[model samples]
Target chain A: MTRILMKGNEAIAEAAIRAGAIYYFAYPITPQNEVGEYMARRLPEVGGVFVQAESEVAVGNMLFGAVASGKRVFTSSSSPGISLMQEAISYMAGARLPVVLINIMRGGPGLGGILPSQADYFQSTKGGGHGDYRVLVLAPSTLQEAVDLTMLAFHLADKYCNPTMVLADGMIGQMMEPVEFPENYVEEPVPPKDWATTGCQGRAPIIIKSLALDPVVLEKNNLVLAEKYKLMKRDEIRFEAYKINPKNRILVVSYGTMARICQTVIDELEQENISVGLLRPITLFPFPAKEILAEAIKPNIESVLTVEMSMGQMVEDVEWAVKDKKPVEFYGRTGGIVPTPEEVKDYIMKILAKETPAVKSWNG
Target chain B: MLTSFPSFDKRVIIFAGAYGSGKTEVAVNYAIGLATSQSQSVSIIDLDIVNPYFRSREAAFELEAQGVHVIMPHNEMCHADLPIILPEIRGEIERSDGKVIVDVGGDDVGARVLSSMVDAFAPKGYEFLIVLNARRPFTSDVAGSLKMMRDIEISSRLKFTGIVSNTHLIGETTTETVTEGYELAVEVGRAAEIPVAFVSVVTEVAQQLDPNVVKVPVFALSRQMLKPWEEKVKAVRGL
Candidate 1:
């Protein structure tokens, strides 16, 4: 296969098209508008459809309608824009529609800066819109991984019949990298969905919806959704462990762009005879809680440190996974500022020097 | 000895190309080179309204420290992604100062910002160059590169007099990669009826590049527009 140099946004859009996603509906948003621009130009060549919706609110419903017809559909947007689509996301989840969503996250709360950030961790891993529904979230650290996960998200959504999201920061969306797609690669054949509201031409009418007016039916529907999430947790968890061993004293848990920096930090520390292990979670929703716990409870491990581009969002999950056996600490930079490798190494040095609170607890 | 770029007689230099074609990096290097090479005033105007990251203005501290005046938006609006074109840009272009380097945004959408300053450039006799990177998807071949050149020309309302062969895979660049881009650039320049101005190779690869095949001047580039993690990453990966 011929390798082509592409930006992350364009790569993800192409991967979706190659994965049999023929319909894209989205409004323009930065750090990710390249996906819409590329789609507008390339989709028509493949007999696909691209629509610039009036707003993100409208885009979400458009995806809902398109995916309900049993055709693959996806959309890409940034932070504030993603918030506008949450209502539709929740509705899609409750109705058990298989749709793919990409969140090229920027800084938070309201219309924040257009720099890379991971503040949407809570919104992505947990329920963002409403209720007890979950969106299966995949986070990739490199452009190659971003392309692979984008294609995989479609299959996972169809398999589990739920909404699947690719959570990437703005840096990944903007940076240029060389990547290759399999030539003449065919997608895995998915069974025809009998539940689609296609039409009642000859057989009975099929109703695909979220409205369960009866309490018993609502309870059953919620349980069915809960079972799908449990299956994802059991089967779809993905993570990468680097330099993990019994001699390591500090275990760093990070994901996405932050994890790439931590890998450099770990390599630098190794040259100085300081062994630091890194746990990079590729799946945010089906988080590698068990894997993290196993690494944290090692006899030589001193403390568990979680790093992020936000002010300590995923650290909660790390703390929960460690179960307080090891002192879980957090270091972060928020509001569009990415934490550098030097900063992360210096924080690790402070932990090693017994200057931070983690050492005080260890001594006690 | 390796050949270096001849000093420019034109006061205004503008760089425009497809997105991710190394325009900002080339513009930054050119501004710093002009300031240090000769005892003269130099200014770099960042007119990128398309991308929010990796703009020439991001290297303001380094560029200013090197004695080059950096023109961008003021304090609160500095990092804002909204398109805020500074009014002083036209004044700076019209001043007939020592040297002015304009780093335009990528593609036709970004080149559209240049159309607004057509009158300012008409009086000053500018040297407009298209930075071509064969590694970028849109301009990997001769036809794709020519289409982008025409699109940018039509959008900016300024004809390009030169073509800059700047192709590399960031830290993974090699001498072969530079030569490949130089060959493609020669093809593009021939078809467009423009001169292949020079080939930009990173300092490391430039040292290893054979000077016989490349007849044009060679610009040895030192990466200035690095992300926060790039410093340590280069060290760790030995790039």
Candidate 2:
């Protein structure tokens, strides 16, 4: 394996290619467009299919077409453009198609400014498209994680027969960092085309779609999806805990780029004699709630702060994880703005100062 | 003509223009100028959701290598097409450390998306500059340019801070074309009650034109289509 300096976008694209992804369909949107450009040039070089579809609508359907043919496929886009692909994403989820979608998020309610933003935290983790479905969402903070998670996203989607998303932001997409390419880029064997829409020869043709008219069948399918999501919660939960000593009193929760900032904050706080730790959720969906809860049980911990780029969207999950074991505070800056390490440290200090006497303990 | 507007406290500046109006080229040059002059960190956010060709997002890696943050939606999100607001960008805007340039897509429809974040920006003192290319359709004349500005203002819910007149043809652009565009911007500026902040000229023509022809600031735009020419010139001139 060779270590190369790669932007977050190129890392994901290269990792996907190494993970045996053969079909990529996408429209151009900012921050993440390099992934498409890279795939457009690289996909053909490797005998893979890359289509710059007419629109997001067409690209999503093109994804459906390719995935239904039993080929690993993926697409990428930003906020407003992602809105156009929601219908198709819902269809893919309902159809139980395995596809990897990467969201290099930008700020937006509608065509928001193109600055790096993480306002899509709720959208990505809670299911952006309609339907009683959940996509396996992975949030990567570093270029290496972006590559590793994207490669794993394909495997998870195929193993569970579901759509997976690499929920990243403009910073992650645009940042250049050194990443080691996977060793032995051996293509994974495609699963047997048992359920693909490739024409069934002399047998009943399998139809890949989300339209279920039968009430009984629809209910059964919904139950199956629910069960699978539950299984994912149990088996796929991942997180990175930094400086989680028992003496640590402040727990900071963040994901993606926010987590990187939180790490810097933790480092600064450590130097200032303020005990702080960071719990970064790599998988936003099937979020690392159990891990957070385990950390929250430390009697010495005073409070938990959920830091996000959005105005406290992920704080709900953080509060849920703590379950009143400690007070959870929310601090964030939104609309394509990033908080500095000093600001994050200040926020943590404020929360720590407000802690009740019962919550304060000196285990150290 | 040239006029330099007073700098605001906010770091992010959005340059929005119509399709085929060379907005991206103007934005790229403006960003480079801001970065070089101030020796500060600058980012370019490519918000061009329409017209995939020659978009700022295509220059993400190039800009990143130059140390400018390039924030656009990812390729996969383009497939989902769901309205996904990346809040991480909001975090950056709040940092108050560097200049952030947003190159929005063409047309008022594309510009309308900025309305939702007016609340987010109001307190932060961010400024939105609409780039007007007199050569583009709907902005070919003073009246048409005013209409476009009104529509953009109505959609973005943010008042125009100023105007950057960047009139040019693909390869046929000249100093005269830029001058005429600057004059048109001046007329629109009077009508719209905003200043013509700057006039953009191509790097080649910029050297030939007298700096005093306009009362406003002059920006030198380097075209992506002409990158090889510029590279060759750089090598020859030892720049």
Candidate 3:
């Protein structure tokens, strides 16, 4: 397997193509526009349908149309554009379509600015679109994870019959890094077409829609989605625990770009004679809740601090995972801003001083 | 005769135009017009991400004074690189009050930010208007304008409700330029499957030309800044 230097956006696009996405429709938005550009040139080479849709609305609907035709499809956009696609995304989730959406988030409130920000954490994991449904969200911290998760996202979306989102930020989208494509690219077997809108033949006419005017039918649909989500929780929980030991006192939780930043903070804290560990969540929707609880049960761990780019959206999850076992703290910078490694290290040290007796002993 | 304007129970109208199309000038005046036309609360969300100068923020003071809520990204966290999804704006979307005008940035690139809120507005009805200046680059002809429309739609992921034909060259624009631009808009409107909501004309020329030159209703625009009632009078007088 040859390793090549690729940008995160390019890697995800290539990964999607190799995963059998034959239709790619998108409008170019910065930070992730390169994904659309790359697919625009490559999709034609692979005998795929590539259209720059009329708007994010049209692109999303086009994806819905392509996915409805029983073909693998994907679309990429930034925060603002992804926000526009929420209507379609909700419909895809309700209709149980295996659509792949890549959100390379940028700064926003109203065109906040085109820079990296994790302000979309709540939107991605908690269903950005309105509906009683959830999308399988994969947050990639590195370019390799971006490629790997995108490949997995396709399989998961098809297996569970739901939409999947690859949630990354501008830094990951723009940064060039080394990535090795999978040796045996897993070709997902075309599942039974019993649920698709590929024509009725002799069977009942299939309606692929999210609307249910009848309350009874809508409740049944909600139950089905709920059952699928429960199964997903059992089958799709993923995370990376770094430097976990029985003697560890602090658990630092983060994801996506923040997870990479936490790694640096952990390294610096280790140099200061503090035993700090990290719980990096790769799947934000099927969040690694059980793992955090399991680590919290260990008596040596004293506290968990969640670091993020937003004003503490994901911190709520950290609190839920730790419960009352330990004091969960939150440190964050929001609105298109990122905190440096040194600042994160300072927060970690402050937590350690307050919670760990060993750190107090060393200071004395 | 009676005029019926498109109204929503709680919809946000975003007046997004191309750069140098006097979007700030139109947005400021339109917000005032919309606010006074009906006895409802109208808020202006300044989402200009391109061309730092001549933004809706510049008119924030005047708009706020007119009792129109002015929401700018800078009031909270103004960053050019991070994704700052405004949870506060969600409140406005959920409110059953007046209109929220989102004056987005110019061009497909700048207007792309609307895609982020696809989740929020799709549930609640949101109407997006693409203000077109046929004289601007990429909109100088029918084909070029269609391409721009397609790009904006794909990027924002929101269907444009209608087109606002606003063709002017600062002070150089005339009734002839406005008419040619209106004609070009008809072709674009047909291709995009959307109607030309209004054709904006300067008050000086609007008074001279037969209002029927614009197939759609005419909206009067003034170069000089004025109160909401004054602007509404201009738009209505042109009609």
Query: What ordering of candidates by DockQ runs from best to worst?
Result: 1, 3, 2
lDDT of 2 at B56: 69
In candidate 3, stretches whose alpha carbon ends up further than 4 angstroms from where it belongs are A187-190, A199-204, A355-364, B1-239
- Model 2 residue runs over 4 Å out of place are A186-191, A355-364, B1-239
Candidate 1 vs candidate 3, DockQ winner? 1
- In model 1, which regions exceed 4 Å deviation? A358-364, B1-3, B232-239
* Candidate with the larger TM-score of 1 and 2: 1
Instruction: Name the fnat for model 3.
Output: 0.05
Per-residue C-alpha lDDT of model 3 across residues A116-184, encoded as one tens digit per residue: 778888898898899799989999988888999999988888888899999997778865555778878
TM-score of chain B of each: 0.95, 0.84, 0.83
Q: In model 1, what is the error at residue B73, expressed in angstroms?
A: 0.7
Worst 10 residues of 3 chain A by lDDT: A355-364
Can you write out model 3's per-residue Cα lDDT over B55-163, one digit (the tens) per residue? 5665676677777887766642442323444656667766646777887776677778888877877877776777877665446788878777788888888888888
Native A-B interface contacts kept, per candidate: 0.43, 0.00, 0.05
Worst 10 residues of 2 chain A by lDDT: A355-364
Q: Which candidate is the best by lDDT?
A: 1
For model 3 the local lDDT of residue A81 reads 92
